[model samples]
Target: MPSYALLRRRRSGSRATADHATADRTADHTAGAGPRRRLRGLAYLALGLPVGLLALVVLGALTAPVLMACARPADISSWADAARRAALLTFGILLTVGVAPLAAAPLAALERHRLRVLASAPTEPTAPEPRPHAVRFRARYTTARAWREVAAGYLVAVAGPGLVLLAATWAVLCPIWLAAPLVVARSSGGPVALGIGHARSVPDALPYCAAGLAAGVLGIVVLITLVRAQAALSRTLVEPRPDPLATRLVEVTRSRSRLADGFAAERRRIERDLHDGAQQQLLGLTLQLGLARMDLPADSAAGQAVARAHDQAKTLMADLRELIRGIHPQVLTDRGLGAALYELAEFCPLPVAADIDLPHRPPQAVETAAYFAAAEALANALRHSAADNIRLTARVRHDRLTVDVEDDGRGGARLADGTGLTGLADRVAVVDGTIRVSSPPGGPTLVRVTIPCPPHPQEDDR
Candidate 1:
């Protein structure tokens, strides 16, 4: 082992080295970040120029009729001329309304891309595509999103050129100002003309250099600020404003999904604990009781008591197994959904005609929701419908899981009648699924549930 003094010296040297490394890294980052930000701002200004010009062209086209109408000279008082102008203006108005959305859409998309690349700002998701049968022109013209795009285009046309001009002025002046000392030194021995006074020597140019430094710093600050402002305006006009109702609905749906997942996880945990812990202990106890009965005399009272205890232990063991299966079945975990449904049918008293055709297993949450919904429906049918024969059909169709439980019996099953179906409905809703019951009095009852789920990749691999 090293001496205490030597260890202390080594530790101090290591700490000092670490501190130096951290300072170097911080300095390097600071050096890199300033130039990166300035480059981004400059690029944004340069790109905005062309976009602004294009927007101006589009706006001018849209306003041509109004401009023409306003510029109609106070000469030529002919009725035919006025009528021709009126007809032209009316046609122009119709054309403007038609062309506004077409021009605004591509321009808005380009602006969004520019903001994303240069300003690191992401806009809201675009609206979904219209249906094939939808009236494309009318649908495009009527939407608030389309109008917002038009307004954004107008804003860009008005503000973009002004920002570019300001940036250009700063870009030109700041460099010249910063090079004041260099300019003075490079000039002939005669006094160099500075901004307002003459610089006879390098020493005389010091004040101008200081002023240049200040101006350069100020210019950078102004450029960054204006870039940020432009990005904010673009985002405000291009992105859709969040609707309070829609936001709340999304939150509620997410919360419900989380709760459903938690419930499924908890069920699995309970099943695991019972299967591994309590069930094992119960099995061992049953074996012990059986051994005790065998070792005792058949005629003795002790042997009879042992026999009765052994029988009770076996019964309890079976009940516990059933309880574990009910919580979350081992078969469901090991053999996927189709096997689990068949196992469920095996336990039911009524003869269940199962027609299960699944190409692959769905997500765990969806599978759990579907299994419980089906189980509840079948239970309700067996208890209330007095059904002698039942049909359970489960299949994956169009990226959705559909399960139908139909029974032939005297049926008056109504969800509003305060049955278990209400709880089932709530359960299905947690996973964004739906349950429907069609039961007429004195007839066959059909309980159908539909849950949206894509096939699992692991199952696909299998």
Candidate 2:
């Protein structure tokens, strides 16, 4: 260990060293960075055209071999010929639509850095949300950015670069040829031929050099034009388009339909389980308890208990049966919506008259939607509408089922009053159905529901 003073001295020396290094870095950054940045900018401009040209070259190389094979069908076996024809057609479409877009993705991702450093344009990117594989794949081709990028690729990677390459070659070579007279003037005793024509003397070099100078100038102008054009094209094409609300509405509608289908299937499953499994077990238990009661003395406490247990089991079984029917009724599946509506009307608190006429049963989905809508309507009328009499009328025609529920009840029934009308409406909408409630402040309420019914499965099979 050193003395405290020595340690302090060592620490000061280290601090000085670090400070000097930091200052040097700052100086370098302030002075040297500008030219470094300028050269980098120039380098970017210089190589941008070539980069685009190279992309075109790569696209050609990648696609050419397959394309050549596709061109001649007779050279390959018949199956292979057919397969390659299909593949070639697919490739042609991919190329026309989005092969360029796929190619541009990498460049677009990195181009921001190049633009900020060289072109002086910068844009922030939005964060991407995770999506299912199918959705992501669809977006790759369908997005406007991808399509615009496709357009940009054709101009930047193919057309712009091609012109730039040709002009660049002439620009570089012609200027050197402008100095050709010096060498030619001494080398040959006779006239030497150049592009413009023969040069007999040193004075003859004027036209040659002037022509070369003009060509070089033109080439420079073209290259500059191409660079600016490419940058602008990229900016325009790589941005996304604004989506409309109608599109979102369609998606929401599809999602609701899927959910409704899933819910209906689940209800059916629950009904099947309760009816076939639990309810049967309870019924067996009830029968066994009745037999036990018969074997015991009537006045005994044990006998009384057994009798009571049997009655309770029977009641539980009956309730389970009702619950299962409520979930998904066997009567609806067997006898159709018309019969189901009649059965529901029979159970209503208020007297109901039903007029249900149909040539044949509709599709299961349509029947289910109509049955539930009618059930909800009847319930709503009895509980809130204070209805004494209800009329349930249904008719199937023109590939549709229309049901009308009319009640002579208290004047007002609004969906806003939380009468479950909106829920029923949504259920109807899932099957491409419509519901209308016409209820004014006075007395009668008419709820009309219409559902599309596709051709019956038997009709479809025929």
Candidate 3:
């Protein structure tokens, strides 16, 4: 039965040890394992050495008097009794005064090291299991979480020493030969056994020693167990989270589909408006003017009426052409983005300079978006920003086309309600281009846009 009990305790202890080892391995995996952790441990060891030495020296200094009194034959008949009492008193004082601050140093160092390890951990981990909780908790709860973790390290501090003390006390008591001094002195009942010399007087001292050893061991075990528990909790709580690749891919596909639909809808609206409204009006007006010109020779008053009708027809033709150009100009469709931008610069009321540098033509979608953004910027400069001179520059570089409209005008552009700038912003966004308007209230408004262009045409590149 005793053998069985011993075997069971060993097994339980082994499992606990294994669990702790596994936890540490997991934390190491979560936090970049390898020479780095070992290096950090070495560094902490180096730092902790001086501190440990200082503690030992200071404790020795404080304990010198007690050591002397225990060994002194003149002061006390029994050194064991004096030493044991002093040890109890000293341990109590140290617990009350010194243990807290002394333990804080290692706890703080460990925490700082752990945090650094966590920070250096891979943000995108490939492992299926979540990272050690300590790393995750720190990332989420930040400093507050780290503080709680540090506070929980005390359990380890208590357990290690407690176990050592238990082992030492067991050695001191169980040996029959070692206990002979007390047994012989008690049997003799001499002056040594009575009052001052009680190696013999305290017959039950052996049991008392065993009980004290057990208590000390239990306390230390509890402390270490508590610390390990806290460490496990931190690992389960703190690590970074990963998103499945499938979810991300699906979101991207949906966005592209929506953009394609928006592009097609915008193009159809422009085409229908031009064909139904502008093209038909221009065709009808041209026919009416031709009939009026043919009727001019019949009568003088009738000729004047015919000429007036022709003038009205000519005005309608001009409006139709402007409307058609606004929808999608023939020059842009035929010659490409460069020719369209040049025309825009020429029409601007301000003294505008054009710098068109394109190695090759971009896609139709890119060209259309760039042209309109430039046009809107120039219009804003002419109307709102009271500018005298403006510079228009366009370039296609490294598979990207960029348009910049800069003016030395009163500069206050904002994304307010019903502002044309807002619509211009939306138009740029539709093409996956971004517009940056740096219009500070006094003067000089600049609008720059960049759009991702498809592969350049080889002929245009030449």
lDDT of each structure? 0.83, 0.76, 0.63
Q: Pick the candidate with the highest lDDT.
A: 1
TM-score of each: 0.77, 0.48, 0.43
Order the candidates by TM-score, highest first — what do you get?
1, 2, 3
Candidates in order: C-alpha RMSD to true structure = 6.5, 18.8, 17.9
Screening candidate 1 with a backbone cut-off below 3 angstroms (N, C-alpha, C), the clashing residue pairs are: none
Q: What is the per-residue lDDT of model 2 for residues 1-462, given as tens digits with 9 covering 90 to 100?
A: 469889999999999999999999999888987787566645656555765665567556555655765686677778867777787767765664545556766655544344554543445667777899898777768877766655655555675456656666776668656885774678656876674467878777777787778877786676657656766666667555557786798899889888887898889888888888998899889989989999999899999999899889999988998788789887887788889999988877789999999778887788889999999999888888888899999997788889999999875877677788999988898989999888997779999999987645433210
Q: Which 10 consecutive residues of model 3 have the lowest summed lDDT?
A: 191-200
> Per-residue lDDT of 1-462 in model 1, one digit per residue for the tens?
469889999999999999999999999999988777668767777778888888989877897886686564574389987877777778777877889887898889878766765643445567755667456566568888788888888878877787888777766766666677898889887887765578878888888778778878886787778778877888888876787998999998998888778788899999999999999999999999999999999789999999999999999999999999889998888877898899888898999999999998887777788888889988888888888999999999888899999999898888888779999899888877898888888979999999987755344311
Clashes of 3: 17
Please count the clashing residue pairs in each candidate, in the order shown.
0, 1, 17
How well is each residue in 256-363 modelled by candidate 3, as lDDT tens digits?
Answer: 647855764576478667777777877787787778778678468887777777777788777766666676666776788899999888867788999999877776
Off by over 4 Å in 2: 1-244, 455-462
